[model samples]
Target chain A: MLPMFSGKLCQCLSVTRFPSILFLGVIYVAYVLVGGLIFWKLEGCSCITNKYSLLAITVLKMIKAASLSGLSPDSNDTADGFWKFTSSSVFAATVVTTIGYGNIIPLTTAGQIFCVLFALFGIPLNVVILNRVGKYMLAIERNFSLKMMWWVLTFLYFVVPMLLFKEYEGWSYAEAIYYCFITLSTIGFGDYVADHNPAINYPEWYSCLMAAWIFFGLAWLALLINHSIDLLESVNAYMRRRKNAQTQV
Target chain B: MLPMFSGKLCQCLSVTRFPSILFLGVIYVAYVLVGGLIFWKLEGCSCITNKYSLLAITVLKMIKAASLSGLSPDSNDTADGFWKFTSSSVFAATVVTTIGYGNIIPLTTAGQIFCVLFALFGIPLNVVILNRVGKYMLAIERNFSLKMMWWVLTFLYFVVPMLLFKEYEGWSYAEAIYYCFITLSTIGFGDYVADHNPAINYPEWYSCLMAAWIFFGLAWLALLINHSIDLLESVNAYMRRRKNAQTQV
Candidate 1:
């Protein structure tokens, strides 16, 4: 099994991964060089005012803060009460998925950079997680009725948040479901970004909280989508088997 | 058959189409309202200057112009002898996929806007298209032959441009491929945007062309990814069929 896995990995690296990496690296260097030149040229274009400079600095600072915050793993593990929720599989999936709805962006430049790096890493990590989830879903299908399990799992994970969103956000039930679907899909149109409520004066903390919520929610949805796909495959397989058996008979 | 098609259409409308339209409508209204308020507030802010305002206007105008130019569907139909080599199906695929390497783009605001809209429409449209392509691919598959087809498709669509990008743009072959992949993916890390070469120095037209090319290219790449996913689904279905047949036997 190890040999097989390693062989497949080697093939993947040689065929797709290495080439892609090299290609990206070259493009990135060229882009940086060209972008630097453009910025240099534009620097003297009389449009680079002190205010614009300040805004640029602030944006950079914000990005830095977010990155640093992301690198240091969530400290929610230390808390006993409500913090227990953070340790849930749902939360774990969220962080790994990176559906980070700006409600919970980094507060420091280092943190922001870490957050970006984490997101880059998290995309592939989520794919791995989804694969695991897919296996579990397949197991569930074999042990019980696929439809029943799907409904039960989806209700436990998806319907609950959908209801909570409707109530907490004062959204219509349909809109809540829509939000859930959109957020989970990562199409993030930013129509319903969290932590924008004027009531939430602590924007930074609020943003973080919202981001955490979105991340988990999205991960759960991704798992659900994977499971659904697996179930479809299983059903298709079942049908093919019956057809073959009938032919044999 | 008509009834069935209509029923499917109705179901689609109810589930996806209508909701998307409604969602976009709500978003647009909210955007205008919120954007208006923000603009109004910013207008009152003492930090804003006439020059900054002018720059913002210029940027908006440029974007608008590009969009409009892209929408001019009649423009590219007039075959200029200069671009005969770049007008092949494969090259069209390349341009639409955005492996441009500063070789092509629109030269008007109208063109740019059209390109932007085309991209906006094309990404989702291509998803549906690739789903169909996947079905065709599965039907054509015959064991080892299938793998060869995948490689051939990848080489034709991906590798060739990679080589060309390196030779034409002074990029390493790897970087060229990376640029193609990234641009195609619409990740648009904004690292390597198009620059006007001396031969194509009409600034307005050049910018528009770049916009259009990027839009189309990104869409094509997305379509390819979708196609790959569909292929995976087909393989999974095949595996499931075999597994079930074995179990039943």
Candidate 2:
């Protein structure tokens, strides 16, 4: 019984050559750990800020002082222009686009309600706008090979935007690239925001340009993700057919 | 020339029919404005906690004190548990899931890079999981009419979760239902968070349940959204055919 079980396991292992998924998982684990260590060093090193400060200071001390006294450094930024005309415009753009970066939020009850209402119209309007833009892009991209289309999109969507973001935000190339990926994927982790700080002097038309950029960039990403799904579905269907054919044979 | 112009205008209006989109836009504006008023009354009326204090205190004065004194209420919460195990896990779930409320954030640079890496694997894994779940739902829902599918989904995704959340967070039924809509739509404004403050003494299994809720809830939403697209596409195809037939006649 043991021999038969072992034989079946070996056969299964042989059928699935080169454990790529397992290998990727290991690599991913290592990558995230290293990232955590780096973040711990950069942001979480001190009790004045980072969460790991509890390691040095007792938990009781942290809770007592932090829960009261309003001494946390992060406090000042949360409500910074939480409501203002220009920021409100950006807020509307972000929410409707479904980026919801949570950088500048509606802390007031009114703001939260407005957010919902804004989303109802804004989401549908944005969807219609994005679809229109997508149809145009698709028409232009027609007859292009998938590889060529990808390269063109990468050039237009990723490269140009990364350069612009780096220039406007004074972010490092890595940070700008990271921001592009986060925003385009709509994962929108609000850590690295562009045109957020009013103290930073940007172009007068900066907001307008940025909004247009987001609109077009998101449309491109939607197209790419949708196209990728089609490819995956076809591949899946082909695999299923082959399996059925093999079984019948 | 005037008669010809009038004839063209009439033709355009008839083809467009009720101008439903514009009517919807006006209705949407009214809905959001009403929402804003309600929220203002509920949470924005006071400044001790709400960000709308500037409406009373003068922006210049608040900015001076806030910019200098490091006394932003939001600061304390941003890093409340920015790096603790449960918070980090919650952060991971939020980030990959793209529900980033920004209620908590990694202030350090290292945390940002780690976020990028986590998202790389996590997003794809989530997409695959959601797709599989969507497939199962689509298979099961094949025989059901659109209205019936929508009703079942609302009951499962919205009503059930709303009840669970209200029980867990002690939020009002309205707030719970609002949360269900916001979260499932992935709007994630961060004003109303569940299970954040450990002092609240929620059920021991609360976190586990919340995670499961998010996973399943997101799958249901994915199915609903996909089903909607199919309905819209079929309607669009039918409309186009009818137009073509009318033109031929």
For every model shown, what is its TM-score relative to the native structure?
A: 0.33, 0.61
i-RMS for every candidate: 13.8, 10.2
Pick the lDDT winner.
2
Give lDDT for model 2. 0.57
In candidate 2, stretches whose alpha carbon ends up further than 4 angstroms from where it belongs are A1-86, A107-114, A117-125, A142-149, A231-249, B1-86, B104-114, B117-121, B142-149, B227-249
| Candidate 2 chain B, run of 10 with poorest lDDT | B47-56
Q: What would the per-residue lDDT of candidate 2 be over residues B36-111, giving only the tens digit for each residue?
A: 3332333232223212222222432444354454434443342332334455556666766677666555434454
Model 2 Cα lDDT, one tens digit per residue, A21-115: 23433443343344333323332222232112222233334433544544344422322333334455565667767787766554334444545
Model 1 scores a C-alpha lDDT of 0.41
Clashing residue pairs for model 2: A39-B110, A39-B111, A43-B108, A74-B75, A75-B72, A75-B75, A76-B72, A109-B39, A110-B39, A110-B40
DockQ of each: 0.04, 0.12
lDDT tens digits, residue span A1-249, model 1? 556545544554444334434443354334334433332333323322223233344444443454443322222322221122222222223333433222222223332233333334333434443443344445444455647866876675458766766655666655555455545554332234333343434434544555445544444555654445456446545765676688699
